[model samples]
Target: MTEEIEAQSFEEEDVEFFEFKQFNKNALSVQLDTDTVYPEVIPPYPSLLAISNTYGYFVAATNEGFIYASTQDLHELFDNSEAGSKELLSQKIHFEISEGKVRCLRLSSDQLTLIVVVEGGLVLFYDVTKFASEKAGCQPFQIMTFPDDIRDLRPNPGEKYNLIAILLVSGIVYIKDYLLNNEISKIEGSKVGERFTAMCWSQKGKQIICGNHLGQLMQYTPEGTHKSSIQPPQELQQHYVQNVLWLESALFVVAYFPVIQEDDSELDVFIISRETKSKTLYIKSPTICSQISSDHPKLPYLYMETIKDWGPNLKCLIICASANSADINLIARDESNNWTSLNLSDTTRAALPLSEVNDEDTLPVGLALDFTCMESWITRLTADENTEVPPVPILYILNNECDIVAYRCFHKDAFFVDESFSGMSPPQKLPVTGHSSGMTLPKRDLSHSTTSTQNTTVLSAPIKTESPITDPIETGSPIVAPIKTASPVFAPIKTASPVVAPIKTASPVVAPIKTASPIIAPIKTASPMIVPTKSGISNNSLSSSISYDKNISSQKKIRTPPPDSTPSRNLGSNQPTEADSKTPHMIRMNATNNEINELHNLIEELENSYIAKYHDRTTEQCFDNPDAWLIGDLPVITSEINRLEHEASSMSQALADLRRQVNEFSHDVHIDYVKTTKDIEHLMYTPSTITVGRRGILQSRIKERLETTFKVGCYINFQRLFVYTNLYLCL
Candidate 1:
């Protein structure tokens, strides 16, 4: 959409920009390795959970090597005092350089800390305050790792932060605390067997429910005793279980497969009784899966809803967003895991970004929906304290107030109105003291964007908007910062010295070394201002942009158009105006006016009006009215989007291919290097009997005279080479 808009307003838009970089006396100096390409690191928008209303923040990792923290104050990250050319946040990688692409992130209710699970199965406990503090940067307190990639992590709702369930590829669940003060216990099934992708604590808090790679959703005692297997739809039986949650007395599960071509490719949510085994299928759409959640744990009649599905294709996903859209839906679930909603239309919603397209391009990305709707992903749902209603079920429905299905609550109304609560802090800024130019991380180029906008805005807007619908952060080249040997370091293993291998596949612990503390640079007393990644505009310094503004300044620069019509508010209000229906560029000039604004805002109103008004007209007519846009069915529409998406995906893939080629080329070079070394060693150890002089004539004659050596694997059909047997020798 940005690209397309750029083209549309190509002549009119004053393409503006701002940037931050190394220009100070302490200049941001790189290794100056011209021969080596720097690793690209695109930052993913991460969610953090800390001791609410405390002095901390948690930065979640992306599929790439970067972590992100949002402001404890929502007003900071989103609604800054004003808009600017570049949007900056205080949150950063607590210690700099992500352990790897983060797989799952969970913030305990305390909001004081968070658990970060990276790709390749590494877990790190981050102290959000250290980085956010005006004094110290966010730092790591502990590091615990596993062999294979981590699947998911969750704290027991039944326990007061006493235990957390960690899922690993080894098919074991580790129950431990963040403090690691206790030993880790492994949980596995007694009857059926396999790794579990999703887990949930029963309402009574005595039982646990889990979902596996194969859609085997089942219940068990908290003590690890296995119970009955809750059957899934026959078609979805083999699908990977994404998430499981319990509402009151029921167990709800959702699972789907990677392949979206068949009818069974969609997400499936099933509700089953722990005792009776009576079950129902809430949603069976090929492309849409239902999600269950509740804000109603503390209130009645007010239900939280949610849904899960791939937005465009397997590449992009639609998760529940705090702000709603028209792409996906949200629903409700109970402790038994059964979805029990009165209607689907009344459900709230959220959105999440997915891959650009379904391609093999090596990019790191992941999303976890709220626990209320943690069907296709792992996310725990907690209500916003600002709401007066306690435990109101936040039914984030999948459909747009259309075909509704199952709904229920997890904790019940009694769980609501927990007065003891803490609010989240904004993101923290920690210096990356250990970032080294070693490991290769794949990332997108923040410096450039295409001028095309072919299928950008054609998404099926969901009722609830997750994060941005698009993968805003391009997973870039691997981060190869020369490791500074940051402290709190784990015991490094023998350096595999992966000279130039796939970073993803490179050994986790490659260097063996004693732990050392980071060499601290002068700590910036003030918060670092927002620095732009591109064209130089922002002064990359701590004292310049970030200081609290004394007056309303930044956002005033953004030009907002005027409102089209004064809206019809309450009874006895003024009648509608003629100009309202026919306005061109409607803007909300008066933010305070209740009479002029559309109920859903212009974005929603314009979109709804466009579809309702122009969809039935001829394409030629629709094109004339800029207000109306083009849309098609899931298949036809997505097919076109697939084309544009493939175009962008090709670039990512090409980069991956380039990296692969580099690794291959490097391997070849290494082999040649080894062979050269060996030849030299052989020359010195068993000095070649025949020594050639600097002049070639005598040496050629002497070499010709000597018996020719066979080249292995080289087919020498040379009839005259009787002395040679092998070809293409490592000789």
Candidate 2:
């Protein structure tokens, strides 16, 4: 019965909890429906997106090769129109590309040039202003095509030169000067089966770091020579390098380790030091999605941006889409030099103003395919002086369903409000009457009607009334609305006035209370009790007497040493004093000194005995000339050294002969290996040398034997027939 009751209680709690959750979810949905505004201007099936920093406009490419650009700023484009309106659609300017489907769209660092990578390894460059113009059709000013399909292209970070790095479908990369239309150099993969998946140029465009499918990072100079290669750690050996980014002295590498179960795959980010060629930090995320059909499988998109003033050790923020889910992971380097992952959906739900839901299981499902950030939307002041405030960056994500979602990135303190006046009471609302006749009512003061409590003090002002207006039958008068006046600022409440005063008495004098002040007076007694003083004097005598005591009774007495005594020796001194001669401690010290002297004498006697027994020399002689002992064995030592040198020379000669023989043997082996390889190749290519089945060979041999047997039998039969005929003729 107890168990059943407990179960019933648990069920009741669960039901209540679920009902609360459902209500909150519904409220959140309604709030989102009212707050979120979807723009109709975004084209369907957005494949590539690029924002212009100079003009504050954005261009998006569809899967059908249609390019759409907003005529005005993207922020204004959505703000000026209502949801489901065709007005925004008309504001968008579009042009179709005949080249092919767009693969990538990038704006030059100067924000003046637009680089478009389309199908068939074609790179088209056009002016940003012209692409977004009101014209119906627009063409690229320059076009460069490669024999192989282009994988990725990056313009040099330096605005001085028009250099571009082009990665091809084959593992080859080309560094070309777009202005001159000439190839500067080409970089190829070092290993046979290695293919580059991602490539990024250094900040200064001095070096390029490329990640290959073999989970290795290769660094190359702009001059086309390989600089160095970094292999992934042992644990990440099975993972493929998908993306690589270079910042300062470290390389950020993104690797994907796919499992048999696609949902169990993980994405790893390695922060490798350039000088040490070792990993300084590593981060991993489970359930990172990848394109199975891609030759170099990778996430839908990976983006990175430097976070300014976030923290001393923050470094940068990495945003990438997670696999089999709609959320993106915000991986950042924390102060502890470790990566922390934050799901975008959870963050958004937690940051919602209407709902307090933060359950991970309730996260909305929508795969983030691509996202871009616009930093020029709004500027915010930082704490530093003499520095320009950077604009707040706004993130725009394109999900798998081709819907655009915008998120505003603001500082955590941006929404903070001052609550200094929050303790004050709010003003009361005024009562209103129903409007029946066309007559304006005069405004009256209601502050006099309200009364203050004993703890609070209220201040009243003179009441002012306005004249009422009357409407005639021909002239109509407008109904006057009540005007809300500002509430009077209330001062802090004062304490209540004193109720009683103490009576004056001669024996026990009472202190007079100030009537102007509201502080209560202290009580007085008829006869005062005395508080004993240290000198044992009464209060009346204390004022009259002026005698002073020569000495304080609280002072402690200290003894003074006689001047005749000699000054005591310093505690750290090693010399013995007169006092040390009379104590047992001095006797012990004398005994220790005597024992030490006896030990020294015994040690000298032992040494002398050892010298006399072993060397036939005095101890003094041994110490004075230590080399004398080695003089007798010098000739033996010299002979041993000579023998060792002879052996070493002979060994060296033998080693040289062995080395020569090994080289000859190796040469012969190489020749034999080459000859055998060629023979094997020849036999493999020759049709006649092909192997025949054993059954076929046996069948051919049997057929030959049967044919021979048949011929011989026929000859024997004819001979028998002739003999038979001759025998018959003779008869």
RMSD (Cα, Å) of model 2: 43.2
TM-score: model 2 vs. ground truth: 0.43
Q: Under the 3 Å rule for N, CA and C atoms, how many clashes does model 1 have?
A: 144
Every model: Cα RMSD to truth = 33.5, 43.2
Clashes of each: 144, 3
lDDT of 1 by residue, 1-731 (tens): 11111000001111111011111112111111111211223122222222222333323332333344432332233323232212333444433334454445665544445566655555555544444443334444444445455666766655455456666755667665445223234577554446676676664456677877666776776556667666555554356565565655653535444322343223444433344335343433222322222221110001112332212111111222221112333333233332322222222222222212332111112222222211111112446333222211111121111111112222212323342111112323433332211312212111111110010111121111111111111111111112222121111111222111111111111121121212122222233212111111111110111222337442232221233434243212233244643444222312212322233266466668766764456444444454554443333345557998999999999999999987885575456444434444443454345344422333343233222222322223223332221221212
**TM-score of each candidate?**
0.38, 0.43
Q: Model 2 off-target regions past 4 Å?
A: 1-47, 66-72, 80-88, 132-134, 259-264, 274-306, 311-315, 322-325, 343-391, 413-731
Highest lDDT: give the candidate number: 2
